[model samples]
Target: MKLKNQHIEEFLQSGLLDRYVIGDTSDTENTMVEDMINQHSEVQLAYDKLQEELFLYANTNAITPPDYLKEQVLNKVTPRKELEPEYSKHENWLSIAAVIVALLALSGLGYLYQQNTGLKQEIVETTTQFENLERDYELNDTQKRILEMRLAFIEAGDTEKYLMRGYIEEEPLRVIAYYNQPAGKAQIEIAALPELEKGLDYQLWADVDGEMVSLAVLNDLKPKTISAEILKKASDLNITIEKAGGSKHASVENLVSSIPLNTIP
Candidate 1:
């Protein structure tokens, strides 16, 4: 007997692709048909691809048909005409139930399709963010290494240095220095300092001749170098402890350290 399209579809749904290809002969004629299919290269390729898709579908766990699919299939296959005429009254009711089941199956399939599409889009977006973060991390590491090299060069020479001293709430006396060079730019390195009290800050200054210029503010002086723009005209550098934001003019009594440009090599 020739195999019908419905038979092929049913076999596919039941996940018997391997059995169909191998031509198991215990049942007779199905074995012969399987042998023919195996011999055809075109058919074999199509079968292999179909098997891959079916395996993916099984693993995804995303496709779920409505519960009423079986009931709808049974209803359509039942021999209604062979039943007694008394059952005619019930035929309309069965037909309506079958239609409802089909509608529900269609809705379920549509919802599953939409969910699968959304998950794919989310995966793509997360991959893009990960790539961007990797690039930023590499750039930050390069900039940090360059800054360290520059600080080592400054610490090796007789850079002009100033000292600042201040007391906050009877805390231990704190001192910091301003190191300026004749090359127009300088860095401030804190050496031998007391811990700062809560809610107070230390600031650096560059006093050119008699005129003082503010340089930077230090909150937590951890052993790391910070970059500053080169000063255009400054002869002296000073440091002072100021109110949190610092003051417009250096309070004479607040002076912590003073270093002149002529003294620095």
Candidate 2:
């Protein structure tokens, strides 16, 4: 009932109307075409036009047998002494007209099927495109927020940048921290940290006057914010490999990276 112009055009061009008018369609096709004709005004109009054309063609090409041929048919029937009657020219013409109408109906039905199929495909494609666009928008929004936060950190005054690397040459770990001592604000970027084995976690600690205090545990790549209380009297920031869920006391023997904070201006 609700059809697009382009879809209607496609249906009309598919030549199904011609097939139906000529009685060359299946039962299923007949049902579909009938439904379309009932629901879609465009389809019904097209079907009407096609039938008119076929009728005109049939009339223009109709042939009338001569009188001699009719006599010969009647004579043959009489000689056989059979009571079977000979068919009249008008009767033959009627049969031809009926066949033409059946074909037209079949063709129309086929066209309807094609039109319905096309619409279904269009709907699926449209839905997929919408989903893709939505996903892209969300990703862009998240990136925009991150960029804004990074810019704010850079513009803030009295902020110190600290790059914390691995203690050993073979340990490929790099973490960046921006600390605003005056404002008691801090953010950490875990840029490059190798995946730890199962049942182990990377834990951060603040070394305050030779005593280590747990800061936060690293389990994901998301940005981490250090609490102001942990940075208040911290002299150094340290990372250590600890068991799953981290430890209350720092594992001194598992220290991986440490950066002295006393040099901050």
Candidate 3:
């Protein structure tokens, strides 16, 4: 009973309404027709108009055609020749033009796709090159820092020294002290240093005459010269391995090297 636009068009074209209007219907059929009419106002209107036209044609009995007139009409009706469908020259040309246009469009799209792919690859390569350059720059910066630290150590003037006694399972201590007098700075550069355990750091101490002074903390054992201002006048130097950042007093037992400034040039 429910119909869409397509269903309505199909029913109209099939002439089903003419058959239904002329037939006697049961209660179920009457109910179905009523439901359809209620659901679609357009369908109800079309059905009413068709019924009116059929009723008028069926009831008009006085204006009948004569037998001779009917015969003459039947004689005048002739069979029509079927037309054979053929494509024109212009139609053939148009079809070829359409195919050519489609092929050109597809070729253009493919070219654009390849160009885009190439551009993306180029961008990726360029980005990788930039990353490599950045890594190189970082390495160079680290090297520059190390060189600057070395230069600062060599330029120190004020000097101090302390004695670091060796502990059990470790070798005897040996280290030299150098100070920059003008800058009131001191550095403890170690030689013949022992290998340090992991997570431990070497700490320098300045022995000013007899008093002990913390100088610098060192993690690298690459013959580095640590530079820092002397807190007091000193006479001896000491080098001890302790926890990172060093301690208030030397982990005396972990001493790696110790020497007096009087022995150095």
* Best-performing candidate as measured by lDDT: 2
lDDT of 2 by residue, 193-264 (tens): 878889988899998888989878887777888876677788889999999999999998999888888554
Over 4 Å off in model 3, which ranges?
1-107, 113-117, 120-124, 127-178, 183-194, 222-227, 262-265
lDDT of 3 at 141: 96
lDDT of 3 at 70: 53
Q: List per-candidate RMSD values in Å.
A: 12.1, 17.0, 24.3
TM for every model, in the order presented, reads: 0.48, 0.56, 0.43
Distance from true position, residue 223, model 3, in Å? 7.3
lDDT, candidate 1, 201-224, per-residue tens = 677666655666676776665533
| Error of model 3, residue 237, in angstroms | 1.2
The C-alpha local distance difference test score for the whole of candidate 3 amounts to 0.58
Better of 1 and 2 by lDDT: 2
User: CA shift at 87, candidate 1, in angstroms?
Assistant: 5.0
Query: Which lDDT tens digits does candidate 3 get at residues 24-127?
Result: 34446545655666677766887789667754643442234457755644443322234232323323333333333344455566668779999999999999
Which ranking of candidates, highest TM-score first? 2, 1, 3
Model 3: ten consecutive residues of lowest lDDT: 83-92
